[model samples]
Target chain A: MKRARMENELVSKGHVACPGCGAALAMRYVLNVLGPKTIIVLPACCWSVITNRHPECCLEVPVFHTAFETAACVASGVRAALEVKGDNSTNVLAWAGDGGTFDIGLQALSGAAERNDDIIYVCYDNEAYMNTGVQRSSATPWGAWTTTTPATHFKGQEKKNIMEIMAAHRIPYAATASISMPEDLMAKVERARDTRGTRFLHIFCPCPTGWRSSPDLTIELARAAVESRAFPLYEIFDGAKRRLSLDPAPPAPVADYIRPQGRFRHLDSEQIEAIQKRVDEEWLSLLRLIENNPA
Target chain B: MKEVMMGDVAVARGVKLARVEVIAAYPITPQTIIVEELSEICGRGELKARFIKVESEHSALACCMGASMAGARTFTASASQGLLLMHEMLHWSAGARTPIVMANVNRAIAPPWNLWSDQTDSLSQRDTSWIQLYCENNQEVIDTVIQAYRIAETVYLPVMVVLDAFILSHTSEVVDVPEQEDVDRYLPPFKAALTLDTNDPRAFGSISGPMEYQKLKMARHEDMMGAVEVARRADDEFGEVFGRKYGIAEPYRCEDAELILLTSGALGGTAKIAVDALRESGAAVGALRVRLFRPFPADEIAEAIGDAPKVAVIDRNLSVGAGGIFAQELKAALYDRERRPAVFGFTGGYGGGDFTPEVVEKIARRALEMGKPDSPTLWEAIP
Candidate 1:
């Protein structure tokens, strides 16, 4: 029965992603949902490397590898072109990384959102610049230690509130998903695919190599993130109505999410307590927002 | 009907006539009027197109790249700093062979924040594989925009139609804006061989190893070189429809002249007056207006000069370490020839300064008197 229900895998088996890479798994789910009538615009990211090089791509769909900071704008262009070609069916997807979304590509993202361009912008947040050896990005957690932020000088600033920023665009759809919940991720991908204008999907993807976690624990870490509210699973429709996807019963402590990752190994007890308090406060605020803004 | 219009409006008319499908632009001074007029044209529902008011010049070109890759005729306009901002995407558009046409108003790059006529801004992008057409008058500006689409689509290379900032972009002239039917005959609907089509799924600009990369680059180069012939053919086809044709290099009375001066953009008009004055005074001089800058038209330029003993090449833009750009290119083109003329390099009319007839005449006399090319660029300033 499980075999009969499964969708044909779009991403090929042999690929270059590190073992237990949440990003690769996330891509599998995205492609399976998006199907063949999709054109993906990939900026510089781990996926740019994970996908097999020229003459051999992991996905069956056509992929356009563009310059970093151009995924959103390029996708807008692609969407516009498709509209001109009288193609109202194919999905135009901008698949980028945290650095491409939260850092250098912010302006382009804002431009595409403001225009209400018809496209799906998927930003796979791995917390840091993993492709370039785990340099800290704006998406990196408050206390995580990346190569740029050593144990002596861990990241001090909180991760940027990308969901709020995206919501501010007032786009047609904005959602947060986790690789651990493939069904939810696929559902959001499908929702974004169905939405007409500037749909944004922020997927929390764990990097086993960058986060210094056991390769096999990638899924567990991803699930713990959502249960701990470190990375909540939610959706904001029409950019105003907020709805939570998962309500974890007896939700896990933030420590359960942070404990296994080497990036968070430098945090002492007091720092861990501070992180837990911050997560709890954020979770409470999110609940209030969901209650306040009914769909 | 000949309508009195600003140079920028002439460009807009050309874009409309060509039936460009996508216009992505971010306003910068001097070039703003062009897009503003285009915006009005698009708003009135006179033209069927998508007007994308992009956030920045980088997105402007990238949008055009996307539209062109999707097989739509695309255009954009910018000047100075905005053009500089689009440096990276310019290479991408060319390498990807997206046939996009853009109008670049020649303005001085800022450090001192100057917005005047200077060629350095577009000349700086010499290696981006974009076909550059420098217009001397408003009519040529309008005509070249249409021809640009024809040539660019033919060569599958981006085209930058350049005009002097304010001197031409803001100046008004009587331009015969071609009717849509005529322009339609001149430039056919865009049909691309390769595009982002779901019906025919294929990846573009994927990762390439050194050997494949070299071949792609070589193919692009061959196509760019082929544009020289394509541009000439486009000019001929345009003349058949519009009755006015500007060749790669249009020479004024160089048949038996001993001295010839070369100029580009609006400086050509000034040089023409200087050539006539020199001729009336029996100096046996002529002027050649270089319309096409890229696919440099070296042999044509050499042929036009045709053994003139002395050649004075005026450059409104400089290369700092390398004298004058046009002079250097002319010298290099004539270097191996058996009967090479002595090419004099003169720098003048930079930063909005007028290149009056007297200034041009003086440069010509100096070139004739020196009888040989100068080691450095000779500065000609209007007193």
Candidate 2:
């Protein structure tokens, strides 16, 4: 399949993001698609520190660095003001980490989504609180090792179904894309930009520092997750209809997705089987939604 | 035209007259009416503005910060816990130098879960770079709201206009709502010196080193001190156009008086009545209403309490380990003075209780008997 081409990088080189940081790639794609007429509402996250300090911001767009839990709400305000100022072409983008979006910022995100605010909220899911040094977040999948959820007591709960949570808000658009699939991510961003109401894009951003994985394996891991059906690429419309993005030949073993990362190195065969069971179950459930409410 | 309205409604009218572009608020007790009225105004198309109904107080102020940063004149109102919830964003809004104005109904902070008149909620936020104005009446509430925008915009700082819960917030009085054209002349459209604009892109509240951060903080303080002069000038100009002028501090019958009672918020009204009663008996007592708490109004306070032998500071809030918040500020203001008066700090009305005129007089008489404050702060009018 021919991949869509991107031109003119908005995210300049020499950012502070760790090598092979999926969030950096995701941001580059986002800014490229959204263009320069954008105002970003960035909450406290890795991206907050990743952007170089004052007088040296990499992104050539206005950014409002808000408190930890106010990305969506702040974006809502920016959109409203721009509407009042009669500059409707400028897109207000709320970029947050998984912790900011799924945990601390959930109320504000829900509020903005419920209001059908005119903004695109992007939650870069690094699975755990990476910027704070590998602390466990609600997005930390089952059987994952974080500083808070040490190897002896791995994460007991499955990652929070944030896409479903956003879908429940019945927003105009909500999609799950990946850092490896820049075309799909950019296409979703383009769609969200054209959409008038609240559009949520949950991107699976891999953090090599937090996951203790070989930095070169970041994109490989991102692709392996999707092919393994652990993190299936899909999109939901108006909180109901769903459309699957990929049709792989056959599902790869969950081990292909998990074995490379040190966070999952402690998992035994039975635990891996348990995780595989959960992933397969989740994939089946997602397929059911896609089949029932075809988009 | 003169219209009978509660202090909260007067606040809405003031916001309307100022042509505020965006308003965000959560419905908290005593502060709900202001938001409700603002919403109504927006609904009726009387005020061409966006009224964002935020989920919590934190989001309310955050929304205001965003709108203000987007170069909109923004406003919000809250009370007690709601105001407490907005504490972080209060610092954000001020440090970012967004001249957003907020009305805070003075309600007791909860532990006992009371929702009546107390100044502790707003007073506790004194360190945040917001200009604090305490209103003594519904009229002052309206007038100060208009002046707050001018001073805040001039100084690039946020302003928190405080009114005593129930006493001023719920009680109705005749307030002269100024005409919209006159208000327009007094307060122009907000032209933000810096904001989130695509044409001139810059980050708001980005990371800064200690040296740059210190300079930014110093500049904000300079702006805060500059607000004193701006506030006075705005009031003088407002009086020229609106025919009503209120100073940062109002000295009532304080001239040649031996004992002057210092108070703020609606308690000043009660103190004024108490002063009149004492004057009838030739007690030579007076009242000085400290209207502007921030910018501290130190010089005005010193001038008002000048040469007076004693000052009984009636504080409806306490600093716990320290003395009364206002009394401590007043003492600091007089610390470098040559003719320093004996400042007595008396605290009352904690957790939604009232400090009536009789209680205020009792505190005054006590201060008069003691000649000077022997203790740091004495509890009075407590049940």
Model 1 misplaced stretches (Cα beyond 4 Å): A1-8, B378-380
TM, every model: 0.97, 0.98
Best by lDDT: 2
TM-score (2 decimals) of chain A in model 2? 0.98
Q: Where does candidate 2 stray beyond 4 Å? A: B376-379
Top candidate on DockQ is: 2
Clashes of 1: 0
Query: What's the lDDT for residue B70 in model 2?
Result: 93
- Give per-residue CA lDDT, model 1, range A256-294, as digits (tens): 999999999999989999999998899999899899996
Model 2: per-residue Cα lDDT over A1-295, one tens digit each:
4586767477876688999899998999898899889999999999998888876788789998999999988898888788788888998999999999989999999999999999999999999889889999999999999999999998999899999999999998999889888888888998898988999999998889999999999999999988899989898999999999895558999999999999999999899999899888999999999999999
Clashing pairs in 1: none
